[model samples]
Target: MFQYFRDSNNSKNQVSEFILMGFPGIHSWQHWLSLPLALFYLLAISANILILIIIKQEATLHQPMYYFLGILAVVDMGLTTTIIPKILSVLWFRAKTISLPECFAQMYAIHCFLTMESGIFVCMGIDRYVAVCHPLRYSSIITESFVIKATVFMTLRNSLSTMAVPVLAAQRHYCSQNQVQHFLCSNPAVTRLSCDDRKINNIYELVLAWTITGGDLGLIILSYALILHSVLKLNSAEAASKALSTCSSHLILILFFYSVVVVLSITHSASKTIPLIPVLVNVLHSVIPPALNPIVYALKNKELRQSLYKVLKMNIKKT
Candidate 1:
């Protein structure tokens, strides 16, 4: 419902709902863009579900790294599902109106999942580090208890840390503007629409980004550096190659995830010059990694590949 009010001196209306402008420069071809976006969303959901199933069914696949992977699959699905359907609705059906509560919920989910994903990556990096650098201690250090604890801790940390983002946004008085430039209810996009000052919101988000994402990335880098050093010290080239091979899938996923994030951040800064680019990149960020993570792991991990084939064959026979 659209709400309006007139003050003593100035006329202003409280924004009850926000209109999502999906893409600025490509309205003519925006409907066509929905096809690929829908495909990516479908792929992300199915592939991540498949990964979760394979991990659960295969007894041999139950380990710390795989457990972390199962968690990643869940996070990836959540990350994509939070924003894609609404985006597709905006694209295909031209359903752009979102209520304030729905907008806040979407914003909270997006930030929480994003932070969780980064935390999971950091945990996965630690798993790789321990496995490679101290093979003998890997089992004792990266146990199931450790995985459970890490997952719980990160979930709590990310949830609490990101809760304030939407809370802060919701508290603001949206007196005039209600059209959000981006497809989703992002913090920056939503907060920018507020008539009130958002300096506190901006500053808190900046510190939170650095504290969570930046901290996670730094930990991941440090783990990889140690893993690399340990691998280089191995006596046999074959051993070193094998050691590095185990980390290839992880490394690739990390690169793809963080590289897109970096590019998206840059595009956001230059959004004035390249508005459409940021929107496209942001959409891709939601879809691509989730769609590709399962494929990459299946391709790189022989055990996972074989398990997937077995699962597929079993399903085929049943059908």
Candidate 2:
């Protein structure tokens, strides 16, 4: 809905900078927080990279689930990379400014990764459902060609989807306000900074959530429902138990991921009225979940657990 307000000369409307309001903490505590945040970022990157390496080298992991996990790792890397380093700079060096292009890049990267992660989760859910429901056909159902095509579709859709945000934002004149309440350029945050008509940006923001986040969540839930239904049909307790275990971890992850996004959406929309709470929720959305996701998945999955150890051993040996 937003269009870029270009000067009549069609030259760049030069907006030099943006202000970031980082978390509220004591000065000493902010530095301390940087230590932990940096550690978490390192861990996230290392763990996700480890997962990717293991999946690539281990023939056993050349399956649909691990393939989706690989995709998740990539998305995790992109999302964390987009937001965390800038946050670290603010916390560590007291630099809390971003240029307009950098702001747009961050927004695009964050939303692109987010959309991919959501779509990847849905694909993962579908894999699990098929594996549990029609084990006999699981192989054929999620084949190499199928995976390739699905990956292509998701990559294209995700890459193209968030573009609307910047496009919409481009329509608005940004001379009046330039302070972002939080770290990084999120759609709503940047939209708020625009001085021109924000209706288009706002509309696209809502539409993006519904179509990308909401749509992905809907598919995930539907996949899980089918999986649960199929699991119920298994006559053997062992079969049912195995199926339940396979899905339980996914269910937990799906719940957490979807919850964060939905809460962020609602909280942000409400921030116009209830300010502090929404900001807190946004921080939770950006930080806690990314830090926790790999940890939880690695902890719960036997393969990932073993792969992590293998990764650690390799690193130690190299060092």
What Cα-based lDDT does every candidate model obtain? 0.88, 0.75
lDDT agreement of model 1 with the native: 0.88
lDDT of 1 at 307: 95
Model 2 / residue 93 / CA error / Å: 1.6
- Candidate 2 TM-score over all chains jointly: 0.89
Model 2 weakest 10-residue run by lDDT: 1-10
Q: How accurate is candidate 2 locally (lDDT)?
A: 0.75
Q: Which stretches of candidate 2 lie over 4 Å from their true place?
A: 1-14, 24-32, 307-319
TM-score of each: 0.94, 0.89
- List model 1 lDDT by residue over 1-319, tens digit each: 1121112112332767899988878777788888898999999999999999999999999999999999999999999999899999898789999988788888888899988999999999999999999989999999999999999999999999988887777778788888888898888788888888999998998899889999999999999999999988899999999999999999999999888888987888788788888888988898989999999999999989999999999999999
RMSD of each: 3.7, 3.2
lDDT of 1 at 301: 93
